[model samples]
Target: MFKAIADPTRRQILGILRGGRRTVGEIADNFEMSRPAVSKHLRLLRSAGLVVTRKDGTASLCDLNAKPLRTIQDWLQDYEAFWSDTLHSLKKHMEEGQ
Candidate 1:
């Protein structure tokens, strides 16, 4: 899943799908890359379970899964306090230097 989202294009695709379901063409329209490139990103996302695609007649509709994101968020929560403390320490050091 992390590998799938490692690309900026894939991340943007997720953000776009967050608004609602979109057809493959709609997704490709937002990016400067070719439709095939966008399709490749979508394929990776689908493999990672970050997004699901369905056939709507001749068009493929994509929607954000979000469940994998919740898992990723839960894992990141473990480091939240460490980040907070580091930020606080940095702020204090800067203030003293000033």
Candidate 2:
């Protein structure tokens, strides 16, 4: 999943799909790339379980599954804590210098 979302293109796709479901064509419309290229990105996202698609009459609407986002968030938690500690130390050092 991390590998899939590592690309900037894929990240933008997620952003486009953030509000609600959208057809592959709708997603392709936002990018300069070919529809097949967008489809490939969607395929990777789908394989990662980050996206889910369902038929809406003649179109397929893809929606964010969100659990994969949680996975990414959990992975980022360590970095969040590390930054928090570093910021705290920096604040203390600055206060001491003052």
Candidate 3:
């Protein structure tokens, strides 16, 4: 899943989908790339379980599936406090020097 989001284009797509569901055409319009290229990114996102696609009549709507992101977030939580403490220590040291 991380591999899927490693691309700048794919990450941009996720940012757009975060706003709301969008049709393939709507997504393609936001990018300078061709429709097929956008579709390729969508395919990767779907494969990674990052987005879900549904057919509404003739249009395919893509929606963000943020469950995977939550998992990633949970995994990163352990580092948050460590970085916060490190930053605080650096600030204190700088203040002492001043």
> Model 3: runs farther than 4 Å from truth?
86-98
lDDT of 2 by residue, 1-98 (tens): 87988999999989988978899999999999999999999999999998898888998899988787887799899999999999999999999999
Q: How accurate is candidate 3 locally (lDDT)?
A: 0.95
Determine the C-alpha RMSD for candidate 2 after optimal superposition of all C-alphas. 1.9
What tens-digit string does per-residue lDDT give for candidate 3 at 48-73?
A: 99999999999999999989988888
Quantify all predictions' global Cα lDDT against the true fold.
0.95, 0.92, 0.95
lDDT at residue 16 of model 1 (Cα atoms): 99
- Tell me the tens digit of each residue's lDDT in model 1 across 35-94: 999999999999999999999899999999999888888888889988999999999999
Q: What's the ranking of the predictions by lDDT, best on top?
A: 3, 1, 2
Best by TM-score: 1
How many pairs of residues collide in each model? 0, 0, 0
What lDDT score is found at residue 62 in candidate 2?
98
Compared with the true structure, model 1 gives a TM-score of 0.85
Q: Model 1: residues >4 Å from true position, as ranges? A: 86-98
